[model samples]
Target: MVLAMRHGAHLIWVGLLLCCMVDMGATMEFTGAEGQWARFPMWNACCESEMSFNMKTKSSHGLLVYFDDEGFCDFLELLIHNGKLSLRFSIFCAEPATVLTNTAVNDSQWHAVTIWRNFKNTTLMVDNEVKWVEVKSKRRDMTVFSHLFLGGIPPELRSVALRLTSAVVKDHVPFTGWITDIKVNNTESALLNSAGVINDLCGAAANMCLNGGVCNVINDEPTCDCSQTDYQGKDCSEGKISGFSFGPLSVLLTISNSSPLTKQQHDMIIYRFPSFQAVLVVQQFTENADILFL
Candidate 1:
């Protein structure tokens, strides 16, 4: 009995190992090389079902995209639609039309795109920033897709079984970069898996720096060196904040006789900065307010 139990336990261990191997082998990568793409065909019964999806894309340039097919509703494409470098949700022939955000996305870095929809409402987020939102009282038609195409396809080719490509085109540009960490409906997809993969490509790439900042890696950590300039922060994102005297400038606030606030009356003071300089709003709340500037 003891020997039989031990044999069964060993079989279970072997099964677990095989599962791990399958998971680790699921991450697929494609270079932005010409004419390359990836497709995953799935057997989804109710393919038109609404889904909540989270996908991450790490690209240095160009647009990232994906396409899905839903039989009756036909097709849906998530891309930088209408030739703009912004995120768009396009459902072919849908009544409400395609939705898009004004935020430019060709920044050549890692960006996380999240889409959530329950037929009535749809929300999209990019790089932890909510890009677009729509709420409707009536439910919308969704795609009943059996396959997903990652990059390369004409928007009109819904029923066609065309292979994925890396070729560039007018309507849709093939994604030429790395994509990972994708989850649908809180469940990880086998085709979009990134288990046990060391994603050091960000560090390996030559021009990871932006805005002329120097890129360097120290002890496995990547850092951008930006020094002695008005542009502050690690990525040199902050604009120039100079031209003012260095030391701490003191100011005295005196209530204006023209617009004086009565006792026990609260006043709100708001300062709007000029357009040429940085946009800063200084608001003050007081029983008696005073405006002071040097």
Candidate 2:
């Protein structure tokens, strides 16, 4: 029995150590120079492909591309067009539906961009900001498509690429920056397995939680649950309302006048219905008074 217990404890310790290692090594570094791009196979991006990536650009005016497939100029792709972050969806050479941010993204800073589709609506997120828009056009079958190029478009002829003859090539410009933390359909992609690349974001390692709250990753998004009952906010950064206390059948309230010379009138009216067993309370207080209800 002793040996068995020791072995089980050892296994648990090893598992925890492995989990810590994975959490620590969760981000990936992308060198967007020298025509370097990540390639995800066709099977990985078939159908409605949702993508989320964090990037820091070395230069401002370059492209931040997500997908580059032939035959359609837009059809299920995300890119930075004319400095605006744009998400485009096109079908069978039809008029492409696009969602663009009002502000420009060529700020030479780290930004998180997420693009996903829900029925006809395309959702885009830049850090904490989000924009959701429905596409007027009908959805088409994209399962037949094969392969997707990330960060950079595929070069023509594979060697000694010709000058800009096709307009498509010119538009499919490569991103020049550092890209990390990429997810597709809420799942981490295998293409981010480059050297010195971490799997998760920086928050996964430390300080994601605040005020003793627990930090959790939901759908690749970091969220915090405030530990104290009187604390609230995204990272438990704000204080919660702790003014009122109510019993099963009673409520307590206290009010104080702000100034000695000022006359403050406060009224709390309650209406009770004996037939319905319902009660409603209306409170009117002056600005000079501080009221606390428990």
Best by lDDT: 2
> Considering summed lDDT, which 10 consecutive residues are worst modelled in model 2?
192-201
Candidate 2 backbone clash number? 12
TM-score of every candidate: 0.41, 0.47
Say what the RMSD of model 1 is: 20.2
Report lDDT (Cα) of residue 174, candidate 1. Answer: 59
**Pairs clashing in candidate 1?**
35-166, 36-166, 60-108, 69-145, 70-144
- The global C-alpha lDDT for each of the candidates, from Candidate 1 onward, is 0.45, 0.54
Residues 68-187 of candidate 2: C-alpha lDDT, one tens digit per residue: 344443346566767667776654444657787865666777688887655456688887778876656555433224344566544441343332222343455566666655567767
Give me the runs in candidate 1 sitting further than 4 Å from their true place: 1-28, 41-63, 68-72, 81-92, 133-141, 153-170, 192-294
| RMSD list, candidates in order | 20.2, 21.9
The per-candidate count of clashes, in order, stands at 5, 12
